[model samples]
Target: MELDNIDFQILWLLTENSRIQWKDLGEQIHMTGQAVGNRIKKLEDNGVIKAYSLIVDEMKVGLSYTAFILIYMKTSNHNSFIQFINEQNEVVEAHRISGEGCYHLKVKIHSQEKLNLFLNEILEYGNYSVSLSINEIKQRNPLIATI
Candidate 1:
């Protein structure tokens, strides 16, 4: 669990390109491929590296609309609402927060009509305020930021 400079370097390289071969990564960091693999496996086992992700172009994939929804619950019970969010494929990211709302949701849909339908479905659980994103300026890599 204690990460040294080498581990940080490996994390930084992995964040830049997760699919890079272990040997190539080792070459960059001056280590053997097998050693790098052992470190990576350790990271995974320790829950430092949770999962590998793919970044897709949403527009090209027909997911043109990105909406941020702030949900204000009508009732104290949240299980039903949580289940609804879990079942909705459009709800890409969901977080429970303390502030102006009970929950925050990041949603992606293909069209305005679908967005409208999604919003209507949400009314069953709570009232929501929606904001549409015109552009994404930056997607921060936490490893790069920390290292």
Candidate 2:
């Protein structure tokens, strides 16, 4: 779908707070609530808006440790390893890459002991190098205008 300035404006506002009421959003863009809703529905139908997500405080949730693991596979077959990571709840993100390793994973766990146990489980598939995050500087979605 082709998005005009109005559609971009709607997206910009939605990005700031997804829960904003349609009428309030319409007031901001100088349109009726029904019109705004129509545009939003079309955006969803065309797959412009995939899903709404929440940002949680890891420290508050008891997910205190963030680890990045680079996996070097022992063999060429990767199907089993891929399935393993997919089933592990601690793994938040996984990527297949072209450089030093076969895959890179971002994981969150409650403690160091849990991290060690997770690493041991990973050894069946491959060797890994892990790094724990000291602090998170920034985490955000891309601005609508940039898109």
Candidate 3:
């Protein structure tokens, strides 16, 4: 979709806070609330705005571990493995990757025991190297950079 300057502004502002009121957003850009709402509706209809999400503090929620797994599949057929990851709650994000591994997974779990159990399950489909996050330095909405 061809996005105008106002559309980019709307996306950039919404990226910072999805719950921002249309009236407030319009005030910043010199547009009426109805106009902004119409634009947002079009953006959503076009799949430009897929979904709104909340950024949760995992530590506070008892999700104590975050790990990235680089997967090397042992089996040639990967359909079952793809389905496995999709069904796993701890697997927050999984990407079919290039350069080194077949897939990269971002996972979160409550404890070391849970993490170990998850990895053991992964061994059924693939060998994986995991890196546990020590600390998060920065997290930002990607739309901010694009704008």
lDDT for each residue of candidate 3 in 1-147, tens digit (9 for 90 to 100): 999889999999998889999999999999999999999999999999999998898999999999999999998899999999999999999999989989999999999999999999999998999999999999877778878
Candidate 2 clashes between residue pairs 3 or more apart in a chain or in different chains: none
Error of 2 at 112 (Å): 0.7
Can you list the residue pairs that collide in candidate 1?
A: none
lDDT of 1 by residue, 1-147 (tens): 689999999999999899999999999999999999999999999999999998998889999999999999999999999999999999999999999999999999999999999999999999999999999998898688789
The 10 consecutive residues of candidate 2 with the worst lDDT sum are: 138-147
lDDT of candidate 2 over 1-147, digit per residue (tens): 889989899999999899999999999999999999999999999999998877788899999999999999999999999999999999999999999999999999999999999999999999999999999997766865465
Q: How should the candidates be ordered by lDDT, best one leading?
A: 1, 3, 2
**Cα-based lDDT at residue 37, candidate 1:** 99
Predict model 1's lDDT versus the native: 0.95
TM-score of 3: 0.97
lDDT of 3: 0.95
Return the lDDT, model 3, position 124: 96
Error of 3 at 7 (Å): 0.6
**Candidates 1 and 2 compared by TM-score, better number:** 1
lDDT of 2 at 97: 93
Candidate 1 is scored at a TM of: 0.96
